[model samples]
Target chain A: MAFRTDHHLTGSVNIVTALPAEARPLVGHFELRSSRTDPFSVYTNGDSSVRLIVSGVGKSAAGRAVKHLAGLFDSTGSNAWLNVGIAGHESLPLGTMVAAHKISDEKTGRSWFPPMVLDFPCETATLLTVEEETDDYPDNALVEMEAVGFYATASDFSTHELIHCLKVVSDNRREKKLDGKSVSELITAQLAAVESVVQSILQLSAELGKRRVVPRQLKDFLEQWKFTVTQSHQLEKLLRRWEVIFPKADPFEAASPESRNGRDVVQLLSRQLAEASVEAEQL
Target chain B: MIEAIYIEEAVRQHRRTAEILTRFPKARLIPCERYGEVFNPRSQDFKIQKRRPALILAEKFDNFVLPTPDGFGIGGTENYYFSHMLNCLYDCRYCFLQGMFRSAHYLLFVNYESFMDAIDSTLDKSTTDKTVTFFSGYDCDSLALETVTGFAEAFLPFFRERPRALHELRTKSVNIQALLKTEPLDNCVTAFSFTPAEISEKVEHGVPPVKRRIEAMKQLAERGWPLGLRLDPLIYHGRFESNYRRLVNDLFAAVPAEAFHSVSLGAMRFPKAMFDPMVKLYPDELLLAGPLHPSNGMVTYRREVEEEMTQFCRSLLGDYLPAEKFFHCAPWS
Candidate 1:
């Protein structure tokens, strides 16, 4: 709810899928426009941060697309990376949606656990990323083609909280098989669930960003003054203390050019804010 | 209801595991080498899996019982507690388990015989003639999963056999059917934890209401079961004094003050390690707010508030019962 109309301007999201059809619905819903074509078919809304990449149909493609997007927006690995696509499960009905609690590589017999910290109302299952489709299913996991590549790569680029995979079942052993068109339909049907998950990531990222960011007023003042890296960090802390002491108000409106240096400016603000806090408390 | 049952390969053929499996045929049975592989993984979110927590059946190895923290037990002697389970059936926001564990899956150690044997061996080292009590619900609510685990049914008889030794089934659960179905044991204490109904109704999600818990205590006390009252982690609001006074009045009105075997008073405190995780798990709750700081690696209410709340409640409790029947849980106390 807080992130509407933010694509291509600010905020961060990188979506990766196995096919263009799988990316089609998301590209439209996020209003993402076409962009760079380095690693794979890439689309964006012109903002450097929000992006989508079609990784073709295998692990390498998924890995390359992630590397490309990570180099673009997630150099700090704090932004969200979401892998949305269709998977096959043996018994789960077609079109059933699930979040991955476990992601395993079928070839290596190695698995990665996905932390399920937030309680969204969705059933969870383990997803096994296989190289090719086979007659026999290995375990009771959603069978997919790119989860391992997506998870292993995306995780290296972001914290586990910001990396997630949502899969909609496209085929089961006992059910009628699905084609490219049906797979697109299955994905389209679950866009609402995907949208909810996106909102959750944005909310979490925003919460984290709030704590990390300095106030715009403080940033402007710092840019004007030639402060060293360490002093900049100190200024950030003082700004936060100022905010906690005097919330919903700015302290820069009273600044005068009497401060001789960057350190003087910081001390002047800190002293004034401290006095203001003591006065407020007494009141 | 559990959506799946993950069984450790070692305990897959255990009779207890087999019996539980029969009851949940609809639930998917998953096999794993160890319960931690399923229960302790970081990816399995406690809040998410809690919506449909899977039951993990595994074998316990070593550390069957551990010493309780100082100022915790009823008597002024050395005390210890053990956990047959890891988490609770209810989702109380103040619960320490939220911070101590990353996953919310219910881990049921199928090897009860091993635990009983360990308890028996522990009591055999009798240093003095005075009775030493062993608490049963530190990491979990002891009787909360009684219907499914039959924990009290198994351990009550074990305690009954050794009358000199004691066991306390500490809980906030009203799942007393197994205990009520049979006779109550003198050596056992059915401890019911409580907070003011107003606070509990807000933060203690999934717990039976305070009225119902008191009703269950009444029935058990009438059957001659030694009852315990746990007012640990006492949450304070604007009207804390009036709210707590009302709770104590309502509690004593139903189950007479004389019926309580002992009452333990604990002010709201958290180990420093647990505070941040609990805060992260539920960031918007007012519970974490205060002009408070950590002291000696523990986070608690302001010193004056803690002392006032504890002293006020202790004085009130003292009016109804003797001094020996209450144990103060705050560090200063």
Candidate 2:
């Protein structure tokens, strides 16, 4: 079954962040895969719901999170995909929110993220997804590790309109300094904002579900639209001959034997044949 | 061809212009400063223009010819093509003239004498060893405007006298009544560009329908005028495979299969810079609907997409024409 047929989501915003101190209250459920591994945390504020699956910190981990979420969507019949995470920025002040219009791999020059559509006051620019850790942000607006891979994999499971990747700036790479406790606290604090964005996305998905339709009739019409000119011309010429031969049965005058009667018989037979052809095609 | 002179006349006395006067009597005869002003015009209605369009005549000056495109040999290493007029009467949405020029006005350079002189000199300089191919339908439909202009009637004998030279009159028009009226030339070819009726009806605006063109082709082929088929800019869309197959089948049914001299196939390719302008003109065209991406310096259907279209059309052509006679003009991978 098409995922869009069963489930739909819509919202104006895809994500919002909460500080780590404010995060514990919003936590819905937790899973322990291993003691050595980071715990997978699920959270919801009753209004909006999400699961933060921690795959440990790396490009592969980010890609793995996307695949896990895709499987969740496939199994559960969910229609929307969103990647919400923290990102490092250059030149911009910390805690400022920006939208990524495009995400490209600096090394390979392949775009992984879809172009962003932002509301007023939210600036849009390039976001670079890198494999290397702690490098200078090269002349771009934002830097992230996971958003690109998440988007590239998630896109296969979702419609272009239904998929979104939102990155909130949490660290300045150039300064190389971050209060780790405070960064976590900031994410927990912004839980309400992130939930509101997902709510909006859910509404948009519902609207798209209404517009999706299979064009079975137009496809059939196109299939039967023949290309032969002789057939088209022959039909046209026969129609013209009937019009000349009949001259539309005059209401005021009586049918004459020599002219009108003979032509009327031929015209009636031609019309019957034309009507039969139409009926046969319809069947 | 008889000697004719070019004059800077304030008024043109041609039959087509007379017909235009009858239609739009109050239409002003605006004088242009240069042939380039009207040829590569800066302003005119492109969409409002109709096929079998009338011309606004002006005198052509000293420079009548220029260098041709690279590797453009028709039958030899020294192939060259030139346009004596600018813009076509037919308004096919896929035509390159819509992307090449800024305006839609028909600029007839009333300087037949100078164009002939340049051709004479070019021929004299080349030693006539290598075949010089002069293409006349690059910018406009060659014989569509021939009834009034009498261009083919004049150019046919010139090529007939020079057996080494070959002229290709490429057109999608059924305006070959003039060409048929005159004696058929041995070295001259009347090349026809055709598409399936379904595609032609949807995109080939303001031109004669495909049925009329097929009838004209059959007449020309029957009269023994060497014909060439151009399946260039092969537009691929839904049902393209079946539609093109039907088109080839219909054409072969209408005319003799062995009557064709050559067949050329080219997938659509356009310069990168032409993308914005062409898209602006035809925003909703389906020709731009394929898997298009920028390659090298041009925006074209991706290499795989181009190959699929070319291979499909080439195979369809092979059913009727010999594989040896079928030549692909698409750039090699």
Candidate 3:
């Protein structure tokens, strides 16, 4: 699928929640509009940079929702994925916001540790995704469902650094269950923390987009000559070299009317750049 | 400062781990079964993680001290290298660590005693007449994290007792307070690596400036510590001759040539496996884009360019130091 030109999809954020109550705070804050409700409830902002999907309440449902959301957009690894929902801990108080440093699947015995490269403004805890709900909680960990599925599926599309899970403590030993209104209120109270984490991820994603940008002249070169897949790759590298070695000079000045195809252009550029005297930029 | 620290389950209660944890009280502590579980996974972006890398404390099981490549030494018949850490704190665009490791987190083996024991066994097996040199800072900077690791404070005294064994602490960091406080040992050489000031400022991120490093070296020389100069990986540029000449003059002017234990020169080269990833990490880096070609499974400057750059620097260095003090490192095989 191709991204809509009207939307800025690069450096975007895709949020997945297991319940509408869990996703309502984010959807309201980001000013998202309900785009569809067929397979799953989906909402998106006007620019489509911020998207949310509410999967109904199981691990398999969360996994399918993540896959469905990813299939709708052309995410270029620069977009961030966040799985935000409520979890249960043994002794922690309600409304305590915690980010997951480690995620484990109780049934599959699979685990993933998200690299904490950002200085998040929340406590960190281990998250255990169980197959069935239970009152028993692991020591020094938060218990929940859908995190394993959300994390495992999202990782196939993005790097581990850009994928994260944030959980708000809704139920504990003191409080076994919370009503839908209570769940929505708990998430609403910690909206600032959610915003902070999403902003940091967006900053990182934007920085990555800058690094992956191709030279502007590459498009013109492709239009001027016929290049096979292999030759196109070579042409891009050569153009980047030219841009670095001679920032102010035009690269086409080195090409001749005799050049008929991308192969000839690649060879000519390579030969010219090879003989050029390069200088390291002074600080 | 470290923001998070990943501790291996094996070393969670170790004395060194506890001490390191106390230094960073605010850091988030994450526990794992093995350092490899957090450090060796695929799909971890080196550049992104490098912005704020965590520290992984683990216990290394074996192979603490191993033989250096055939020509990677300075005047020692038997040369071996050991690393207490796996990655450097600085982010030089040309560093091979970015390509060699999947993750950018600093993996420091907390078991220093095990490394010392391995070195001692290697020394005992060596012939008494020949010097057994132990090279540090191959995989990471020896002194960059000295304040946190206490690596120099713990290992200096051990090397002081062995007169037949030599230790080379190679680094580009000016974190030499640990060395300054202790009495200078004759068997230990604190070597400093450098490129020209212009090239260093552009590529070597977070490294101390050239002037500050020279001042630190002068202080070490005054304290009677044997010093070494590493002009290795000579970056090729249009002003190579003038830049290198000025750098050599600045060093000799600050510290006397007699204080230098050795001087070495090597051309910039990387294995194809490493070069490809580094380019992918920093596509706009000028150093990687300049006049480099693949030959014999390694990426390096043309033979003539490498020889000319090395020969010019060697000739300039000869004016200040004798030929016996010079060592030229060949490209890695």
Better of 2 and 3 by lDDT: 3
* Real interface contacts reproduced by model 1, as a fraction: 0.01
Docking class of 1: incorrect
Off by over 4 Å in 1: A1-14, A20-31, A45-51, A56-64, A67-71, A74-82, A85-101, A113-126, A130-145, A153-283, B22-30, B43-45, B328-333
Better structure of 2 and 3 per DockQ: 3
Question: What is candidate 1's lDDT per residue for A224-255, written digit by digit as tens?
Answer: 67677777765665565555555666656544
Model 2 misplaced regions, further than 4 Å: A1-283, B1-27, B36-45, B48-54, B328-333
Clashes of 3: 0
Better of 2 and 3 by TM-score: 3
Candidate 3 TM-score to native:
0.94
Q: For candidate 1, give the lDDT of residue B312.
A: 85
Best by TM-score: 3
lDDT of 2 by residue, B1-333 (tens): 101111124336645335434544433233333444333423222432322233556666666765456654345555556677777766777676776765555666655667778887878888648777777888788987675466787788777888777788988889898778877776787888877778778777767887898899999988888888888767656576787788888888998987787788877677756664565444334454223445687866656667887888888888888876765333222
Q: Tell me the tens digit of each residue's lDDT in model 1 across B1-333.
A: 876787788998899998888888777566667777666645333554566677889999989977776776776375777888999899988888888887788899989998888877777876776676788888889988887888988888888898867788888999998788878787788888888888888778999999999999999888878899888876656677887888888888888777788988777788879876675555444555332345688876667767788888888788888998887433233
Native contact fraction per model: 0.01, 0.00, 0.57
- The DockQ assigned to candidate 3 is 0.55
Question: CA shift at A224, candidate 1, in angstroms?
Answer: 15
Candidate 2 at A8: error in angstroms? Answer: 34
